[model samples]
Structure formats: C-alpha cells, structure tokens
Target: MRPVLLLLLGAHLAYAGKHSLKYIFTAVSGDIDFPEFTSVGLLDDGQFDYFDSNTMKAVPKTEWIRQNEGADYWTRATQNLIGTHQTFKVSIQTVKERFNHSTGVHTWQLMYGCELDDDGSTRGYHQYGYDGSDFVSLDKSSLTWTAANPQAVITKHKWEATTYAVKEKAYLENTCIEWLKKYVDYGKDTLERKVSPQVSLLQKSSSSPVTCHATGFYPSGVKISWQKNRHDHDEDVDLGETLLNEDGTFQKTSTLGVRPEEWKNNQFSCVVEHQGKTIRKTADDIITNFESVPIGIIVGAVAAVILLLVIGVAGYLVYQRKKGFKPVSGSDDGSNSSAHT
Candidate 1:
C-alpha cells in the first residue's frame, strides 16, 4: 500500500504540469480605457481556474466568460494553438495570449505552447499559433507568427496568387480589429463599476518593519508608500507587485523599514493612495505579540513602559525649551530622529 501510494503521488505530480491558458489586453490609446490580462490553469482533476490580471484573484469560470465577449473568440483560439513543427510540447500546454490596441488600432495575436514529458520530466519546448481565421492553411505551424521578434529574419508570403486569398486576408485582419473595438468598448462601459480596496497595516514583530497592505480593490492602480516623520514628503519604501485577490479585486504590500533599533522612537508611517483616498498607518497601530493571550498581555505591559518613556522624553524637551536650553545638532546624543510611503 505504501509503494502504491508513492507511485500514485508521483503520477499526480507529473499530471499537474499539464496545461494552462492566459489572456492579455492592452489599449495604447483610443482602444480600451485601461489595460488588463487574465490567466488560467488546468488542474489534475479536470477543473479550470481563472484569474484576473489586475486583481490576481481566482475568479469563477462562469463569471469570467459571462462578462467578457472576447472570451468566446479566445476560447476558440485556444482550441487551435499550434507551433512550428511541434518540437515544443510545452507550448501547447501554455498560452501566449495578447490583445493589442496599439496606436488606436487593435489586433489579436495568440500562441499555444507545446511540451512533452518523459517519466515526469520535461525538456523546454516552443509554441505555435492558430485562431479561427480561415487562413489557418497558410501558417499551419505558426511560422508566420515568428516575426514577432523585431530582428527576426523569417517572413511569410503576403501576396496570394488568387484574388480569393487576398479577400480572405483582408477579412481575417478586419475581424480581429472589429473584435478589438468590441473588447475595448466593453472595458470602458464597465470601468466605473469597479470597487476600491481596503487598506491596512500588519507586522510580524513589534520591532519589525511594518507592511502596508491593500485588499479588495479593482482596476489595480493603487499606490502604497512609506513616509518618515510628520512632513508632507515621500520616502523610499520597498514596494511589492500588485496581485489579484480571489474575489477578483486587487491587493498589494509596501514594507517600510525601521530606523536602527529605535523604530518606536522614530515616527514611521505607511500611506496607501488609491482612487483619491489617502489611507495611512503609524507605528501606534501595532497589535503586539499575538502568540498567546498571556504573551499579548506581557507585550502590552512592555509597550506601556515604552510609551511612558516616550512621554517622559517629550516632557523633558518641553521643560528644557522653557529653560532656554538647546542642544547642538552635531553634538547631540547617539539618538538620531527622522522619518515613508
């Protein structure tokens, strides 16, 4: 039974890397108001998962296809992905999808990756192309598509001997452009319906850097940053990529580092700027150790002591000022005070 289980597990792993799908839509100008993409993965159990590019969330397959008219066009395209000579089996298993609305002109280009596995191992392979276009016979191996590389020397015949071929070429290109217009209009019509994400801050330890996170937002344009001190200035902060949430919303994290070991003494903050809303977080928002209630209580007490110390220092500064005492900047104590995104 143990041997059988291990064999089953091994088989499962090999089958897991089988197939996936993806889509990307971009509007340079006058095509779509915004740009977005979608990715899909095939599961071993024959289930399909869909993800929105902006939110990085796993959307239900039904909802994705229902809203996007381009899906039907792409679906048919996916069914026909082929590469030149089929050397790359992984190409068919993967999808290189693009919907370009460049320079106010939209075009559709897609490729299906193909790959092969030998006892659960794979060698890198290439991809091929196909759509529902009537010109499939002209480029059966997707050789014509290879010219995507700017410097590629490969070129295919543009002029056909017969007038029927000329008409067909025009039709295929026109159809893609028409589809591009439809896709863009659909995006613009639904653009305003997206929701804004909620922003929050979290920390692993009291002294650790704070991570400002935003969740459940749409359209993926939220900017997160860290600022130091109480000034209206921006500071350098480590920014993470915007990712998709499972609910079709967007989320991202921006981490702000502490100043030496006196992070508490130095005022630090995180600001999430999204859709005209400026949400902020400070070191004061920490929840302390969460391992256990006893630990939490202990941490609270420690925090209280730290707070009292800060208050005492502030009071001393006020008293010193009243007595006309000023410390030289370069001659000050080892404590250096400063303040991000």
Candidate 2:
C-alpha cells in the first residue's frame, strides 16, 4: 500500500504542471460615425454657398459658418470642402478585477481631428475641439460609452484612443480561460482524438535536399523538428503560410528534410505546444505507436496465457505421480512366487 501510494505521488509530480501567462491580446478595428443632425444646413447654389436662417442672408462659404455646423453638413453645404477624408482610431483596454475569477474594467479614448489654417497655426475649431484628449469609456458590463466629462461638448471631431489596465494579471487569466473554453468547444474533436503525424521521407542522391510535408491544425503552436533516436537533430525547417478558415480559425503546415540516414534510424516528433505544456506524437515510418494497448486485448491475452500454463502444469504433475507409483500389491503374491521358484 505504501509503495503504491508513493508511486502515485511520484507520478503526480512527474506530470508537468500547467504553464500559462496572465494575458492575451487581440486587435480589432471598425468605422464609427456620429449620426447627421437636422440643425445643419445644406448647399444649394453652385458658387460655394449656404443658406443661413439666423443671419437672414446668403453667406459665402466661410470657416466660421462651417464651425457651428457638423462636418457632414458642412462638406455637403459647400463644394470647396466636399470629398474630404477623415481618419480616426479607437482603443479599448480590458481590465480585470479578480486574478482568475471576476471581471474587471475597460477604458476608451477618442482623439478628434485638427488641421493648420492659413495663419500657420492649428485652426478649424469644428475639427480641432476634441483633439488630444480622452473622450469616453466603454463599460464592458453595459456595452455603452460613458463620457469622461459629460459637460464638455464638441462640434466636429474624429476620435482615436486606447484603454488598458494597470494590473495585467486579471486580463491574462481571463484570456487564458477564454482561450481554453474556445479550444475545448471548437477544437476538442480534432485535438482530443490524436492523429498520427503524417510523415514522408524523401531521399536525394546529390547534395540537394529533400522536403517532407506535414499538415495539421494546432491551436497551440506546434514544434515540428527532425530527430534521430529521440534526440534533436539540426536540419532545415520551413513553415509554410497559414490559411485562415471561414470560421476565423487558422491552419498551417510545416516542412523539413534531413539526410536519408537520419530518417532511417531515428524517431521524428511533432510536438504541439499549448498552455505552457507540450503534447507529442512520434512516427516511425509514418505509423503511430500506441501509448497503451487496448484494455480488452491485454486482458484477454493475459487470461488465456495464464489458463494454458495452469492446465499444462497440472497435467504434467498428474503424469509424473502416475509414473512414479509402484504398488507393493501383495506380499502374499510375492511369497507364493518365491515358493514356486
């Protein structure tokens, strides 16, 4: 019992502990625009013109008039500034509250557009108002933006910003958990039922090398290496381009070639690295060695051998006992024979 317990303890210790980081990063971008409002006016005549109801006059296109109106209205109201381009950036930061348990925080930033006027200084108040400042925070829980300073208002702006957390531990933990869930849900069928690594050995008579090809999906980056007798061998490795699937997943292939002798005697391994751990599959002539014999086969073979040996030994013992038995069946019969002699 003690020995068995000790063995189990040793086995547990020998099993590699999970290795993982605290965070994962994913980048995404999208187009954002404020809806056009009705207060802004539209351009009607050909000569860079706009109708201003407040002044009760037809005003020529000017910066002051455009500043009060939105960019979409101003651009459409005048032919001079029509077809202008505006670019903005959006940044999101995921903050975690619990190291590996609870959800945390998220921050957002917006940088409005600004440009230099004819006076060699930044102008265009409509575009310049919100420049170089944090505008809002996107609450992850509510999925809505919270204005940092609600009272601060700007007319025309293009915002670019990023939000991140100080304690990255929570972020990493959540990322790892999410990745694990995704891997299990979508990747389990392919990953759990392990496939033997497809291996092909090519030989070259000249100094030129041969290439071996292998294709597989490994959510965790896999290490494809050439080996000789389970030892790492130096060889040229070429990783081909990975193709993304329609489901937003990716698949890649790796190719490597070694000398003919290396392939003949040594074992080659494709090790999949994931979650700070490695799982390996080796091929000798492209065939997989079973990690363990099937339970039914193993039990049947052992039982048959044991039963046959038992029967054979029992029959041999019976034969030996019969052969050795000598009957002193009659002292009387022996005495009669001696008298007759």
- Most lDDT-accurate candidate: 1
**RMSD per model, one decimal:** 25.2, 38.7
Candidate 2 per-residue lDDT, tens place, 83-161, comes to 1111111222111111131332221112111121122222110101021222332232332334434322211011212
Cα lDDT for residue 178, candidate 2: 39
User: Global lDDT for candidate 2?
Assistant: 0.26
lDDT of 1: 0.34
TM-score of decoy 2: 0.24
Q: What is the C-alpha lDDT of each candidate?
A: 0.34, 0.26
Clashes of 2: 8
Pick the TM-score winner. 1
